[model samples]
Target chain A: MSIQIEELCKRYGDKVLFEHLNLRVEKPAVLWAPSGWGKTTLLRILMGLEQPDGGRVTGVGRVGAVFQENRLCRALNAVQNVALVTPDGKGDPEAIRRDFGLLGMQGAALALPTARLSGGQKRRTALLRALWAEADTLLLDEPFTGLDPAAMQQAAALLRQRCAGRSALLATHDRAAIQALGWPVLVLAGQNGPESGGK
Target chain B: MKPVWVQRAAAVLFWLAVWQCAAMAVGQEVFLVSPVAALRALVQLLPTADFWGRVWFSSGRILLGFGLGAGCSVLLAAASAKIRWVDILLSPLMQLVKATPVASFIILALVWVRGRSLSILISFLMVLPVLYGAVRTGIQSTDPQLLEMARVFRLPRMRRLRAIWLPAVLPAFHQGCSVALGICWKSGVAAEVIGLPDGSIGDALYRAKITLSTGDLFAWTFVIICVSALFEKLFLWILDRAVKRVTGEEAAR
Candidate 1:
């Protein structure tokens, strides 16, 4: 029902990203980390995209993730992109369309190729894809990068609303989002944790 | 930088005039035939049943070969991309095929099989390398980040293939097919000309050559070009739809 990371060790050549870093997650948690400090790498490792040399991960069921980059299928429309990962292949297009509307996407934007959408809109689509997929655990890597403050707040609120009663790990340095999320922070080591100063 | 159609038309007219001039200068039908003479000969050939049989014989086998070659190359490319050893294994053989002359293959094919299968084998041989190279590059060029996303999301194999791999592979494959289609026809027809398979266009071309029927030779050349162009257009149209269907994109006309 939850994720367990046990003595995870990852290294890139001479640099050690994580050495014996361990954590247990039973609820939504914010992974507070600065830029280029292996936040994405950590998320990747959790999602089974990478292998830790010295340790093992266990108890992560089906995972849904918003990757650091908007990894949407450019050929498909926003509705199709979300629908592609839905349970039983019965994803509700109308619901997805409605979600896009709330994220400031309207008119021809929803049906247009994801490649044609603005960066912020694409980010929202990736977020919606993760949030909508049938997964017990979610790994979101900087899911709110391109949005303005108001949009970011709205997205953060939506994430909190939908992510209830699920294990979700969000990686970001945004304090306002952190405050809005109101989730316990897991401060990563080295330059991994966010550089904090302003509110 | 003129419109392609206008430039094409100008080039065609210039060639036609030169052809007419050359035929007149030669003053004999044995060495050179005018474009008008060739067209007239084509008109005569069109009404005959033998012409259609020859067309069908050559085109059918050649196209069948191309289809088989395209299919096998894609499968090989996909397999090779996933398994590095397969690529290493295929590299030397594919290079040898590419470097060897078509004439050599045709002559060597005679030793292994009957003449009728020559065009098919030749077309298959000619098409494999082109498709393999293009599809391999396409597979290699697929966005790594998206692949990571697919892996994390635990997207099903079919879904990942339709959404990610196909879209990445198709554009380059399409381009390669464009070049390969022409090569297939040329090599196929050449094999037929050498092998002289019964009831094939190459036999007809050979007969025309032996009799010194310059006009018939010219007419057959025209027919070959038309067939090649038409096949390319039709094949590419189907290919475009297939790519669009897999990518979940809007189909083009």
Candidate 2:
């Protein structure tokens, strides 16, 4: 099974983010690019959140994603946040608590609402939620933005643990994160418009 | 320094003194009764089973109306938020309810239904629009980012409602509830007064006015205020806990 993007074209008020871009994803690959290089636009297109101006995609099913922002439910605790996307619709608390622990969340931290979590902790919860959810394709967009080096490594290790041999796509500008995962990279198409601005 | 309650007590006493002075200056019970007379009347009525019956009668029907109004509004708002035609169809009706006077509805309702049910119908009409507006606004204001996340993760409808839509909708719902609670009571009581349902507080109030029993009127007014305030507090407390529990916010220990 594979996700194939064929001659995809997309634009925003004449700022073309993609044009005649054809790609095939048969294995887990890192989508490597600087900001505003249509990395997010591409991911959004893959998730079907945006429509390509021309062309079509195939074999992308049941997407699980960690958005550019942590986007955790501000009112829910870490366990509840993960449970929200669990396959059976409710995560096993003991298992999730353990998973969160390996990702560096402890007792009080796990119990606290996600709104109160530190940026790194929230980011980890978002990652764990996507990991735990049922999906044939996993998409990560700048998943390591707010983490310290130690936390970043822990996240990378956990990502590897859960995602090995799975069809996963990691999009990031973080060199260390890319190095830690050590996956093949696909640079996004540069903007085919007025000036190239890093977003 | 006095305890807070004691200070409050002193302020209440000062108001009573002013009220008594005003009543004496008026020199007629028809214009105003002293606080003491109202209290005496209240105490005299307290021992009677009829007083309790009357209290139960008005409170139950008003609450029934409130519950139905609030329930229907939330459900309809959920539908209208999704389907454009439903919103468009209901727009004029909601606007008409808001525009019409409570007395007009009460009198109009009396022509179709029994006077006893007037309070319920009026209260429902008064509460529906405010809540519908609140829920729709809340649904509209939900973060597009979170919704996109839910879509990507394939979160089920029930889970999305609980985790995403619910937390987003609650604050506005709370605001609407607060405003609607006060309004439902006022409009319900107003309807009762106009419709003069037998054995109701409104009927009793009408009798008091005709008989010039100023103390009875004052005492009943106090009862209405106390009852409505108590209900507002209770409903708000329940709503707060429900919102917290469903959304998985751990209540402060």
Q: Each model's TM-score, in the order given?
A: 0.94, 0.93
| Candidate maximizing TM-score | 1
Off by over 4 Å in 1: A189-199, B1-4, B250-253
The value of fnat for model 2 is: 0.91
> What is the per-candidate TM-score for chain B?
0.96, 0.93
Interface root mean square deviation of every model, in Å? Answer: 1.3, 1.1
Best by lDDT: 1
- Alpha-carbon deviation at A41 in model 1, angstroms: 2.3
Docking class of 2: medium
In candidate 2, position A194 carries an lDDT of: 16
Q: Which lDDT tens digits does candidate 1 get at residues B151-201? A: 777788988888888888888899999999999999999999999999998
Tens-digit lDDT string for candidate 1 (A1-199): 6778887788899988777767777788888765667888888888888887777777788898998889898888888888988975549888888887777777798889998999998999899999889898999988889888888988888888888898998999888888878888887756323233222
Q: What is the lDDT of residue A59 in candidate 1?
A: 73
